[model samples]
Target: MIFFDTIGTMAIGSRLRMLSERITEDARQVYELYGVGLKPKWFPVFYVLSQNNEKSITEIAKEIGHSHPSVSKIVREMSKDGIISEEKDKNDGRKNNIKLTSKGKSLALKMENQCFDVKSAVDDILVQTKHNMWNAIGEFEFLLDDKSLLKRVIEQKKKRESYNVEIIPYEEKYKQTFRQLNEEWINHYFKMEEADRKALEHPKEYILDKGGHILIALYKNKAVGVCALIKMNESEYDFELAKMAVSSEAKGKGIGWVLGKAIIEKSRSLNAKKIYLESNTVLTPAINLYQKLGFKKIVGHPTPYERCNIQMELNLG
Candidate 1:
């Protein structure tokens, strides 16, 4: 006989039931607002298009983590409802391109605003809960995994963690090495004029002042990379992510991403609202790493020097 009164069975059943009911009710409400014909899952596809307009079906599916067939089905239904349009890909004759129709675009905008309002309301509640919900869910997942399998995975991680990469707070002793790395990086990637190189080599003042911090990544006691965070203003809590350069000898060891994560975590600890970075397109690897870390492209304000560069920002608040 099945034991319904067991703690594990009852807990799992209760949670699953609650989640199913919540999802069903949300889908029903969204369908009623948009139209009885629209599937709630398609809303994410619409939202992605609304942000980055005109993506192929494959791109849409990948971004939304849905299978191509599923996305195709949703697109076909939306096309029939006059909510979206499909076209043949010019470059790839076999692929079908997708974009939002006038009605779909309008609905997407409304949905986006609704999502923002919902997020704001949820944030207020989450502030009090302090992310307890997420912690509970994580604990449940951990419990579900086999103990032996989990121990093996954790042991593998510990073995890899033996590679020691020390990040030291910047000090007078390491200033020369930091400048050397920056100079080498500029010459390698940036076609810096003599004056520009000088400016970087000898800034009027160190990038980080009061309420600012710098870190130098040391690999086996050698200074391999340097990064800085400077407090721009109190209200905005802006910090400049500057002097991020790795030694040529130390390229491609995944050091850059490590330094980036460290800087971001430190900024969060300092209660920063946002972090801004200036970089050039020539540094494709760096730009890719930044995007992977959730930094978005934005317009740059006037700076001390003239370098054709791209500016990126991350909202911490």
Candidate 2:
């Protein structure tokens, strides 16, 4: 139960397996009591071929949503037991069609009558559990067939990373976070200049004391990103939006977007009429975020940092 609760959604495979194992184990015991030799797993292929009379290994696998090798292995065991046989297709020499032997036919007929008991037992369990297990399984299979489990898992990962990110005001505890997150991006793409170091090493002295605001993005209670709006002039609510960085582990999760939005809203609250920023053209994603927030390219007189080739501004009325 602890494992079930702990694993949660991760327990899908195990839970499904347990359901099958429990029911199959009971059915196996039932078969033993009835003195039947067939296994529960063999029913799908055997039952399908009984109706069709002749189906290739590939056809059996496709009918049951099982792999060809798995169907072939079952066919081999059935052949060994003298319960089924294969014949080369007259139209295609490479293809072999499967057929039920006399023994297999006899067993299918006898078990067909007893299958009602198995169905009733399963239905009883479903009733007790307050679930229609057959319908549930059918819907689950239909869902997976419509969109494969792998594609669904991939989309979930991307959505989880990008959609739910949150940004919060910076605190004294996030001193290292501001520095580390910035340093990671700066040092990786370009060398940390003296201007960058002065701000990174002492974020409070360089940014906060200078009438600027710093913001951080948190994912699962951990600060994974930082951004700042540096006040440019003593006269007006003009600010320079800079020092934005998202940790490598949190890059694709839209942390930058969250942090940037927090900075924009903070500037608006501070009566910021205009916001300016400096960046390199190489940082396309970062630039795109600015554009999304109505920041457009503009020519500025001068900049303190050497790496600042492209300048952008947002006019907030």
Candidate 3:
């Protein structure tokens, strides 16, 4: 039924592992037929030492891009079989140097012919296929190396969830909700300072009345995130992004991203050339979000909040 085809990309790892095992089984059979006692798993290390007969386990691991412990285990197994020898380093007692044994050297000579045969067979298969599997695999590895599978999936998840998030302008009805959301996060991280109370407790008086704006993120019709852009002197930063908070329940649903983006657009609409913010390093995720939005870290800024340890500015100019 080709279950993996039905299950789709979610089973990609399983599919690839299955393909690897199939190829390994074929190579194992071929090795036995050719009277070569080498295991397919040992090919990488064996081929490496064939090129450079003497290398430390660390060096081999680096050359092959395998973990040190994994290489160590393989070395131990090959040593047990008398296919490789390990000697204590005279310069560094803690390190062991690896080299192929007499038997392993002879096997390497035989494998050279087998490698040519394998290459010819692989070329035959490639001609029969629509695309070159090696090239596709190389491209896939390059992309995964750039970002990682986990990070790519998280980005997709956020993109999917962002559709359900709605960013709306602030109204008097959302005033208390905004304050509650900010206070929820503040109280959890650090005690609220006087500036926080003045801003959150009376957003209209301290922020809005002075040419500021607020944004609310509605997750499925429920308000769960808020951020404010307080007007600053036009000569300096035109606006300050502050008081951003998202409800714990909606934390992983990309509500924060939507609110931040909306706030930045709001500032741009007000003809702001630059935006500023104050935050603590302890708020790592928040700091990362600001950095992602093109904010650069700055110094020599005074703050009214004791919890503030870092300052950032985004130059829209």
Task: Please provide, for model 1 over 22-83, each residue's C-alpha lDDT reduced to its tens digit, 9 standing for 90 to 100.
Answer: 87677668567644445666777777888876999889989987898998988888889888
> Which is better, 2 or 3, measured by TM-score?
3
- What's the distance in Å from true for residue 47, model 1? 44
- Which candidate should be chosen as best, given lDDT against the real structure? 3
- lDDT ranking from best to worst? 3, 2, 1
Evaluated at residue 99, the lDDT of candidate 2 is 96
Residue-by-residue lDDT tens digits, candidate 3, 239-306: 99999999998877777878888998888888889999999999999999999989999998878989
Model 2 lDDT per residue over 246-269, tens place: 888876666776677788899889
199 in model 2: Cα distance from truth in Å? 26
Better of 1 and 3 by TM-score: 3
Q: How high is the lDDT of residue 33 in model 2? A: 79
**Which candidate has the highest TM-score of all?**
3
How many steric clashes between backbone atoms does each model show?
A: 0, 0, 0
Model 3 whole-model lDDT (C-alpha atoms): 0.91
Model 2 clashing residue pairs (backbone): none
